[model samples]
Target: MCGIFAYLNYNVQKERRYILEVLFNGLRRLEYRGYDSSGICIDSDLSQPSIALDPAENGLADGSCKPLVFRQEGKILSLVRSVYDEADSTNLNLEASFSVHAGIAHTRWATHGVPSPRNSHPQSSGVGNEFLVVHNGIITNYEVLKETLIRHGFNFESDTDTEVIPKLAKFVFDEAKTEKGEQTVTFSQVVLEVMRHLEGAYALIFKSPHYPNELIACKRGSPLLLGVKELSEDANGGTSFHDSKFPTMDGQPKELFFSSDANALIEHTKKVLVIEDDEVVHLKDGSVSILKFDYNKAKNHGGLPRPASVQRALSVLEMEVEQIKKGNYEHFMQKEIHEQPESLTTTMRGRLICGDSSKAKSVLLGGLKDHLKTIRRSRRIVFIGCGTSYNAALAARPFLEELSGVPVTMELASDLLDRQGPIYREDTAVFVSQSGETADTLLALQYALENGALCVGITNTVGSAIARNTHCGVHINAGCEIGVASTKAYTSQIAVMAMMALAIGDDTISSQARREAVIDGLFGLPNKVREVLKLDDEMKDLAKLLMDEQSLLMFGRGYNYATALEGALKVKEVALMHSEGILAGEMKHGPLALVDETLPIIVIATHDACFSKQQSVIQQLHARKGRLIVMCSKGEGPLVCSNGSCRVIEVPQVEDCLQPVVNIVPLQLLSYHLTVLRGYNVDQPRNLAKSVTTQ
Candidate 1:
């Protein structure tokens, strides 16, 4: 939910206007990564270290933005535009006035305060707005900092941890501005100085009225980096870029990259140098250098997470509006949801997936062949992930364990980090992550890789951190899932995991059958998805029928039992209703107490070995007058037959291990439709940033 952009003079004589064009364009590229509102301050000629809360009006070469405290209690970007437009009716380009040197920009995903223009970033402080800054990550002890500042008679504006930076930097700048004026306590110095007094994670960049051309930047427990490159500059030498354009000037983007995902800077450079915690970087014209602010030796940490290859690949500076159009579909979400049936087939696209004895899967075990062999001979496997990704792993766990005949355990990555778990060289660690940038998941994978556990990654983005670091695994060939909630990717991963398990357990099938199943399913998928779409009309009615449900109880048995858990999660995430999932049998032990006409219960009765058990479970709920929605097996109408109160849905049947693969489709649809029914943005849920980069 946060975005960072840095601009430094690239070509010596490029107009500031061109640089601004590119900068604004880059910000637009970053919009998908949801932010409250964007705030920026550029050292253009019209304004020196001027702050634009919401950059409606462009900064100028000589003039700085007015120090107005914009406090609209609405969205970040929205309030920002109103403020920006109000700040100045005309958004005059100030790039030409000052020889632009370097600066940082931000589109904040607010973790603090409401999405108001006042709470926006590019926080400015000092006697006359001498110091300005933009920040990401949470400053945990902000209240304490706020109290201390108040004691010092320091005034504050926004209720954000970021505001402290500009004020604190200004304090230091004033204290050290006169002493050693040049190279001493500049805005960069103030940033480092203020950092000493703060606690928690942050990636920050600052500018000083005293020293306008140079930029001060640092990071700690948060993502930030120097592109170490140059870009087009205004006449005054100011550039709206941070990398050296020429390959040789590359010296590598001094890794302190602020990128949460590599897409931001892949176009600038692939070579990266990591910025360790407490590292201070001063980016100046014709020179890029690092200084030990506290004179403390930086810890040389090993096993630094490797950047993913896809993260390394840069897009063509813009997204295609056409790609998002859903082509022939009525809604983007619906089109994406339908694309899964084919997307899943595509994941198995290159591989041989014939589960039949006639044709076997062409199991391409990345670097895990030896590991898989060991696991085949060893004790067990641990499957882990977070959020929907965790559910994806949960869906694959039973199948992998059953097919491979190896006990597999699935847990959330966040859990493994907080608690010690059973991980051994004898046990293979299979982690599932969509972005591969998940911090906790990365740490969990690190613990496995660092220790001797064989780590396998089933990630969507090809070159993400987890993909690069794991002991080698498959890429869920579902290219670029832009919708943050993850549709096509979720199914593709389940497919890959299912196939991998089957291959490991029984590699006797011929490639032809595996390919046929995948191709047949794939070719039939768009149509199948179309058929599923036909159910949307029915699903919408279900949504309307279930509108009064304050809570839900769901259950499943066997391979898809996890789907019950996922179903409840979906309802909760979108519908904002309280729901719970447990085995139907477990209902008597506890959940049964919650069962009443008021608590609607959903049972995953999809045809599997557990159908009879699911029926018994359903009878118990039905007897108790528990409201129900039965997800029955495709052809088992007799098994699914319920009285007038319960609605029954018969979904397509696949292999037992692949039930989740097929069954989850309907649940995803149910979640999507219900969320729309609840009037929430299904794609970007409020307060949930797309990527959880910070712990």
Candidate 2:
């Protein structure tokens, strides 16, 4: 997974100086999507444009007219610092010189290359820096293309598939000029030709000195959206193909913005276009055009391609800006972890209702309201997702099965694709993801669609691929989760699925008592979450005790087994430690071998059908001289930890089926504090991304 952001100030207006800040802020917002390294390249007309370079390499001398480039091996903030530091050391006003109207910025999640400064994006295609490219998605046939380019005297500095793109552009540019016996070919012409050679999913943005006023972007698979800012009559008679209704800024009716996600541009503009597969977008000083790729048609029509006569509609963002910012919090993870109470409220608002006992408590989910009959009649209910989303679905499986009396199955989206899992028309498959753009989940949804299964999407992103493609769905409304390690989204997903189960159960009379109790529990979940948040100080204290442990194990049973797994995932993901979540029942099978006084194991013994069994698990672990942290009901702590030999974390009891929702809060806090205490990045952990957009 990766993020791409670009901007073009066509009017060369005074606001041009803010280009770097614009790109910098955009990348910071997109950081949750994923990145191992970051970089930016700005337009330059000077034969000697100055910019920061890798610390390992000697930066180009000022006055050498070339695109200014800045790169770093870590987060986007590191690159920002490098850019400012370079400005301080240089005689040239690098910031002022950086005001070239067009540029691209990238945050890379490595694929086909190692995570290093050399592999950072803003890859160059021409020796003179004629073409600079920033890309998202893979180039499957890059090796072959690289070999060919190498034979043509193209050299590579980074082991990246993206490097092939720029080199290939240069190759095409040279080949075309040679064939025509001419010295010049338009940038669009060369790009169009390069498109004929590319295969696989890619969203690309590039700029050339030969075409200084334009930023060209296109995509085949990875998501790309375009935002237009209108200009006033003084600027260029602001014209927007969609509507041109917004107030113009500084004479220019609009500047253009491009990103992998609309979240990146919410602060700039909400009016945007979602680029379709194989469509090319050209943004110039005053005009923007969307082009369709038709090589044969282009060849027959003097190398000029047809524009997409179909004007794609623009959509407004429903998300608020405050949701994406971390207010009065140290990190997004902490803020989001603490936001669970409100998040759960937003999730269940108007969905679960409470009244007189004889009135029959009920749940109403509009998205699934019509599909409940179909779902109840389904032969099987398959839950599909990846990473934390998958764990969320697993947590809700027991509730779905017990309440709806439906056979339920869980599948990791990637594994499902690999096995080509059977999905019959009689089955209902639910796709869950925080950001609906997850490539693997999308692919799995496609497979499920092809097999004729009824598809339901559960995600936070409103118009994402999964949300749009599925026949029915629910939005978790978790708000913008900026941390790479998911917290709120997972809980919100569980809440939404729990609501779905409750809604389906209401159709039958035998389940009335059980369903009503669950509805009451749902009504109180938000407050219960608030009470759980009180465990923060306690969790922090406990984190200090366990910070030095090399490995930790978590145990839970039935509905809570999923809680154990997700708890382990959060710990391992952010704390950078070895952690495992094991079914308490599975201990004697093999996990028992790992128990010892030096090893810390957390047991979820909250009141449930498996309470006694969990008590036995605690006894077994204690008998083995195992260090333990037991999570039990507030009052049952005395019952489960009667011997008073182990430390216990008490959580208020909710309906047994919804207990996992409450039980998980303390563990999430522990992981957060542990990650901070361990001196790790709690928000953006290494080797993890907020959304896993690629397989």
Model 2 local distance difference test score: 0.82
After superposing all C-alphas onto the true structure, candidate 1 shows an RMSD in angstroms of 7.1
Give each model a TM-score: 0.76, 0.90
* lDDT on C-alpha atoms for all candidate structures: 0.63, 0.82
Cα deviation of 453 in candidate 2 (Å)?
1.7
Quote the positional error of residue 15 for candidate 1 in Å. 8.5
What's model 1's lDDT at 21?
A: 49
Please list the Cα RMSD from the true structure of every candidate, rounded to 1 decimal place.
Answer: 7.1, 5.0
- In candidate 1 the C-alpha lDDT for residue 332 amounts to 52
- In model 1, the worst 10-residue window by lDDT is 303-312
lDDT string, candidate 2, 627-666, tens digits:
8889999977778777888899989989988888898899
Off by over 4 Å in 2: 45-66, 85-90, 94-100, 179-193, 231-252, 292-307, 353-360
TM-score of 1: 0.76
Task: After the best TM-score superposition of candidate 1, give how far the Cα of residue 100 lies from its true spot, in angstroms.
Answer: 4.6
Candidate 2, residue 538: CA error in Å?
0.4
